[model samples]
Target chain A: MNEVPHLMEHIDFDTTFLVFDLLAVFMFAASGALTAIRKKYDFIGVFMLSFVSGLGGGLIRDAIFIQAGPPKAVTDSKYLLVILGAFVLSLIFHGSMHRLKRTVILVDALGLGAYGVVGAEAALQEGLVPLAAVLVGIFNACGAGLIRDVLIREEPIIFKPGQFYAAAAILGCGIFVGMVELGHADHTLAAILATLTVFLMRILSIYFDWQTRPVLDEDDRS
Target chain B: MNEVPHLMEHIDFDTTFLVFDLLAVFMFAASGALTAIRKKYDFIGVFMLSFVSGLGGGLIRDAIFIQAGPPKAVTDSKYLLVILGAFVLSLIFHGSMHRLKRTVILVDALGLGAYGVVGAEAALQEGLVPLAAVLVGIFNACGAGLIRDVLIREEPIIFKPGQFYAAAAILGCGIFVGMVELGHADHTLAAILATLTVFLMRILSIYFDWQTRPVLDEDDRS
Candidate 1:
């Protein structure tokens, strides 16, 4: 994306970090477009949702967590052009999406990890405390999906008792922040460990059917 | 709240403007708490929603539009303490809320006007374009309610075919920005006209049962 090049002009991002960020954006954009297709929204709505999902995390991160100027997604023109290319491809292949559910979930899991570490690092760069970093990290990882769900008038998976989606993000972000802030680990190593932890937890949770229940169930009254 | 005094020390806000901002926060916080109660959320849930509803607009504006330092709601202790006081008052009087529905609507209309102007001013101060300023203004007026609805597993009123709520906000913000930027009106005059426009629009919409229709209905296929 053009934003990536512009960011490179300003700051020397690590190669691995840049790759992860790009991958996360690509994967989330596909998911967002796919959601719009499923909801039977119009073409404009599809494009809008795709844009929102692709850039929502960074938008929230730059706006709320990092207190940065305009977010990269908004500044770069190529961002939408690239997203448009992907949108066309997604619409073409959407009929096959159900069959590709497994692959989709695997990639989505990786995006979660990428978003988690990216968010935490952004907050820490702004000198936020560990707790705040953790919250921001989770927001970055899942905020897009939440927004998409809200748009479609569905209960967000994060707030409802679905799987351990937000929990996995929380754990991933917590691990990274804790490792960096408390254990004084190196940035790269902490990020790697956090990503791995979240990815594994997400896959295993889906496999084992783990859940984040509400504070109290409807029938759990004493 | 303590944040107000701290802000006063930093910026010599006109007394009328300061009062509007405080009233907006107080009113939104009350609505947030009331929504939580309607959902039968526990005490902690009520408090958390109240805080979110009260602080969400400023948090979003600071994070997204202004790119300022940490938001006042988070930095000032008195923000939450004042919210807590109102939360207690709301819980005590929530039983009669139905009977007081008309009064509640009137206050909320005023809050929307307050938030809309406040948001536009914050964006303009940050040198954003007129379009973005209007968006931020509407977000300021309606963001807290959107967040509250999402948390409660409901579609936000802004997204649904409700009355002209966000329309009112957009008009108010647009008129204010237009007058200040194009007509060279004074800030105080622009702010007053914008607030009155939104307030009147909201109340009239309710009285006239105005609705925002979908682009295409389910049976409107060509």
Candidate 2:
């Protein structure tokens, strides 16, 4: 469709978006690899986790877009190379990376925002329902982290109370979808705006130690 | 394809296979709902887990079969109804069900076998590669339990050592695929044999307390 070409043109003109996408992949991969290393998984396990964490969300989204043909990750070699590079870097420099905790957190938040916009835009281009597009966007932003945490036998941090993780993505996705529906912005502009909104929200939440309260049991409430 | 009709014909002739398939759905749903209840999840969580555990594997398999149109679980209302029925039943009878631990275990094992045959045959009918068919069969049998365990924040029991869970399914799938490939058995006959093999193996393994050893760490070895 014209939407597909429009998206390709946008990416072709904005090489910065491509760069940020790759950066997001690297950060997500590194986070997964670090979790594996902390869990004392073997090299294979670490590599597997890194690959899944970097690519799983996009893969799921693509799977849902069955009419779009095979998923890009399956056909493209670049994704595999990026994940491999990230895993190697993490394996070799995990100690140093851990020392830069604050930096890593900030980069991860940026990656979250970038992924949200990218995912929502892709879904919208595919003509998904607006609500479905937003959900896909949120999944693209946070699904890999959920998979990573689950693989290591932890409840996903996003699903647990006391985290502002998925909420930021949801807000960003809503903004992008709303902008597109209202014809207020082009895809690229909407993506940029949505990413900035999510990034700022995530940062502020962390800065203010924002948290959600858990739902109490009926007995506890009584 | 001729294969699809052949599978449908087999199911139509032998209503027992259809019954087993439904039973598998119910058992898997019950298992998931019970896990959510034990974890103190809200009703929504219980329903989500039940639905996923009953249908996630087949949904994933169908998603991979992009050429096969929409996933059966999505297109067919029967799966949804069955899962809902199981969830309601689990909610009402969980206490009594827990008391019948042996019966629950046996039914679960039977479901595993039934699901293994059904998944492999479906994949084969879809003309998947033989190895891929077997893998799909194993996924169909074990994938739901893995998702259920993960949602509850536990390492998937199949991935952990000390059980012959997935191994039994693999053996059954291999037998079914091998028989069909060699032209030694028709689809219906092979499915029956495979199901019995898996069921018996699972029962015996549990009876004998079969286990697999964990990989020892290098530091531990030293």
Candidate 3:
């Protein structure tokens, strides 16, 4: 009898979306802060890395959305709060938290999937071409991690030989765009399916140790 | 009689701006491509790095400008053509060109100054706060080089304890914004003054071997 809103203290679609977005931000920020700790960065560096890792991709996506107003990452205070919270937690409990590798990987996968869907949806809403939408989705999924690695003076993991990372985002984004093109007008359903696809693909790729070789490898064989 | 336009074949503000922008793009792209060659990257990687180094800062600045349309680097054909032209030249003459280290340094300084002024002016036009405009100018001047260094898996030179790079941008941007705040509404004069300030400051810094230390260095001393 439509009591879900009352039971959840007036939960709505936007509220649910905000919850997922916050979850993604928290996970990404935690990972980034942990990396900073491992790298022995100072407090400022830790905070900066966490903030960028949590919001950098969304900022890039929003900036490219042409019609979108000022980037939410810059205008919204909540993003900073989330990053700061994550940074504090990471700094305090890093030793114990570092052992939860499996949990961290799972959370990271979920964040990637959610962000991919969010990016793709935003691009489509802005009337971007399908290919561009897919590209945006992939960027939203992996761009933060790339920035984090770069800031730590390491090669970006996605660009190096690694398990399926960006590829999974590409596949999921492609599926979402294809569904919309093929008359699936329900954004929620498409996003759910695409997110699930990316999450599962990323998990399985990690489990199976999938890898992609560089183009230079071919030259060596020849 | 006002014959300036006629003497220049109806050349307008945009045309002159384009000339400077193209010069910066060519120099930055050529430098990036040369780095790629030294790193032994594949052809595709060379082109990609060249494109990013030439245009990444402008893209970031435009993306941040709330009222600006889509980034010109993405929408304009001329930027891509210029990058491609630079890439070809670098690829063909990399060996001989690498010897012109002094010339490359001078050209890079010029590009930095030009981009700093351009970015500050854009931010001011878009109604950003003076501090934000100055920050944007510094970012636009140094962001591309940071990206290039990161892509090649090296510490960004600006971040290291080295010569004054970003500081020069800050000084120039500050001067431009300050002039504007003092009611000097002539954009052309402001830009020219700012550019010359950055150029001269950069040259002097290099010549004098100016340096700044990291915040953590004090802790080490204690």
Candidate 4:
């Protein structure tokens, strides 16, 4: 009876996916806008960074798969709306928000975790192999940060010694794969576990002051 | 009698195609390194900008075609050597070189032209459709600049209104397509003519201060 579709049936939207997607969008957009403000860039610059940081991972994934102009950036304008919304909100609360660095980091971790799971699940849905799915997840989580740093004129944080950002994404992806294999096919459970795993790892790494070594030494410069 | 591959190839080494490639490497590397220095970025930033500005177009084209990492960046290390050499040269003449902005623009135009032809030819070699090949050519010319601008924390010159940068690439690519259709299949002749076309177009556009409209207006700002 569940398989049957009626002409008059009211569609029930999936609330779980909606929540995580909105959370990820908000987190990334906030971080990106703040970074732009710190750099003293113009409004357009702020908008550009926010857009790239939020959509860059998905853009890279879709382009790699030859999807051309990824739907997240092209078809849907919600991402843009979210970016504009964040920009306005940030501008309004710019002074008060400057002291929320700790909060920003936590939200960033949440966004990273959510995006990792979303990217991995999206890849799996596309019938990608597990190895490829893991790669996609890693690319999704850290790829946007790389683009953001590059845009902000900072050395990309990924290649510099870091707190295993990619590693966290990989772990979350592995957990999702494991859950799928264990008959836990529910999207809600998979997303929560993956997101929590990444968030915990990131928070622990930050709390411990884990960081990567700078690639350049005194000798290299001279 | 002239079909022998084992015969001395040195006689044709000085042909237009070889010369164009050499000039392109020199000019593109200089432009890339100069941007890095101007941004006051560290050594890694310098190397990254130089490499991307020199080889980024090819990399993007290869990625689009799903050929994985671009061969130009990998097959030969000459590209790296050229960029490094340019960096060293820039350091040596740093003060005097800043005044050579006009010269840099001219050389950049040449690089743009050569890269456009090379990209179109490469796409044709890959059997891509004509429109795709032209697009690849444009990407090859403009991509490096976009990457450079992004790394230096500037709005990409492409998105900013001014100087038909992409338009020149498009025109050069269109000319290459027309020439190939006209049976001018000799590599040297085609490359030289196409390069000159793009270079002249770019120079004229810049001299005349041609520009485009901004993607977003102030009113559009949130």
**Cα misplacement distance, residue A21 of candidate 4 (Å):** 17
The global C-alpha lDDT for each of the candidates, from Candidate 1 onward, is: 0.76, 0.76, 0.75, 0.68
**Model 4, stretches more than 4 Å misplaced?**
A1-59, A62-180, A184-222, B1-18, B41-48, B63-70, B174-193, B215-222
- For all candidates, state DockQ relative to the true structure: 0.13, 0.11, 0.14, 0.06
Better structure of 3 and 4 per DockQ: 3
In candidate 3, stretches whose alpha carbon ends up further than 4 angstroms from where it belongs are A1-16, A41-48, A63-70, A73-78, A124-132, A177-185, A218-222, B1-4, B7-51, B64-70, B73-146, B155-222
Docking class of 1: incorrect
Q: Which candidate is the best by lDDT?
A: 1
What is candidate 4's CA lDDT for residue A26? Answer: 64
Candidate 3, position B32, lDDT: 83
Candidate 1 lDDT over residue span A24-140, tens digit each: 877778888998998899988888888888888777777766665677677866556667766887889889878989987988888798789988887778777666677668778
TM-score of each: 0.61, 0.58, 0.60, 0.53
- The regions of model 2 sitting more than 4 angstroms off are A1-17, A63-70, A181-185, A218-222, B1-58, B65-146, B154-222
RMSD of each: 8.8, 7.6, 8.2, 11.0
Which candidate achieves the best DockQ against the true structure? 3
i-RMS values of the candidates, in order?
Answer: 5.8, 5.9, 5.5, 8.8
What CAPRI grade goes to candidate 2?
A: incorrect
lDDT of 1 by residue, B1-222 (tens): 112333245544456665676777787888888776665555545655676687788788877567678665544445555666777877787766678889889988987887888888878888999888888998999898887877777767788888999999999999988987887776667777898999999999999998899978888876
Relative to the unseen true structure, what is the C-alpha lDDT of residue B195 in candidate 4, on a scale of 0 to 100? 83
Compared with the true structure, what per-residue lDDT tens digits does model 4 show for residues B1-222? 113233333446235444555566666666787777888888777777777777666676666432534466567676667767877786677678879988888888888888788777776666665555665677677767767777566766654355777767878887886677556555546666788888888888888886654433454332
lDDT (tens digit, per residue) of candidate 3 on A1-222: 112323344545456556677888888898899898888999898888999899878877787544477877668789779888999999999999958999989887877788887777777677666655775687778778877877787766665556777777878888888877665545666666788898899999899887654434334312
Give per-residue CA lDDT, model 4, range A16-70, as digits (tens): 5546666676666767777766655555456556666766676677667525332
